[model samples]
Target: MTREPTVAEQSHPNYVKVWGVLVALLAVSVVGPMFEIKLVTLVTAFGVAILKAYLVARNFMHLHIERRYVTYLLVGMVALMLLLFAGVAPDVMKHEGHQWKNEAAQKVVRDAAPAAKVH
Candidate 1:
């Protein structure tokens, strides 16, 4: 014996459509670099990635049917990630003086000099 799909199942968005949208978003991400605009390409790739993530989460992970608390948790996680990135951004962007090269050159000169002969 076989069972028919329920009304809820019938009302859900078609899996094929969702998969096609994901593929289209992936294509956008792949082709975004061809434009030769760094900011635009980055934004396009990230946007497509976010969209694809949403689609997968909603359809495959069934987040669309999840409770409000789950949504809140996801939002909180995203906020925390942004906060962490902001906290680290300044240190990551800082360009400290290039002391390594000077140290390397000095070490080379020091090593090149002949060692004194021990009696």
Candidate 2:
């Protein structure tokens, strides 16, 4: 018969090591933003952010140490984050000539003759 792991066997060296590694990852992320980087800087910055968060959630938060519903919770959080990130670019970059209408309105205001009636 197969044996189920006792709590002690399942949580030991790896658990402590995980917390240490998670701390290191967090330090790296905190330091990543302090550098005087150039145009491609954001790529690396956010990359570190993602890595650190993953480590914390999966390790320190012990999401991987799931007992019952934690797995679903972590998966759901990750999925929701993915969805939000996926939709962000389109939401930020999309403009279908709506800005042009704003420009036209400004021009109309600028070109309008002084109103002959002031109440």
Candidate 3:
């Protein structure tokens, strides 16, 4: 015998609605870059991405119905990602002429080498 869906499951929004919302968010992200304003386009794209992520996690992954600990874990994961990016940002932003120094050293070495005697 087939079992009926629980009341909680029935109370959730229909899958089609969730899918439609995801599709709309995706469209927004895709169209956002067409704007000439760089900041506005970036914000719009990231905003849509966050919204789509939330919808997928809550509805498709059933995180909304899960316990509080699961939500906390998700939040922690996001925090960890932010921390990692923060740690890497400074290194990415700073450059101390290392490339130029390497090129200068190479040129000096090439100049010191004796010319080969060709037959």
Name the lDDT of candidate 3. Answer: 0.77
lDDT order, best first, reads: 3, 1, 2
TM-score for candidate 2, residues paired by index: 0.46
Best by TM-score: 3
| Candidate 1, 9-100: lDDT as tens digits | 63476889889888888888988878979987887798778888888888876776766688899989999999999998755554334552
lDDT of each: 0.76, 0.64, 0.77
Q: On residues 7-106, what C-alpha lDDT tens digit does candidate 3 reach at each position?
A: 3574576889999988988888888888868987887799788888888887877787777798999899999999999998765544335553455555
**Better by lDDT, candidate 3 or 2:** 3
Worst 10 residues of 1 by lDDT: 93-102
Better of 1 and 2 by lDDT: 1
Candidate 2 residue-wise lDDT, 1-119, digit = tens: 99986534554447667668767766766676677575335655677667777776665555566575867776789899989989886644443354534555555665664652341
For every candidate in turn, the CA RMSD to the true structure comes to: 11.3, 10.1, 10.5
Which is superior by TM-score, 2 or 3?
3
How does residue 38 of candidate 1 score in lDDT?
92
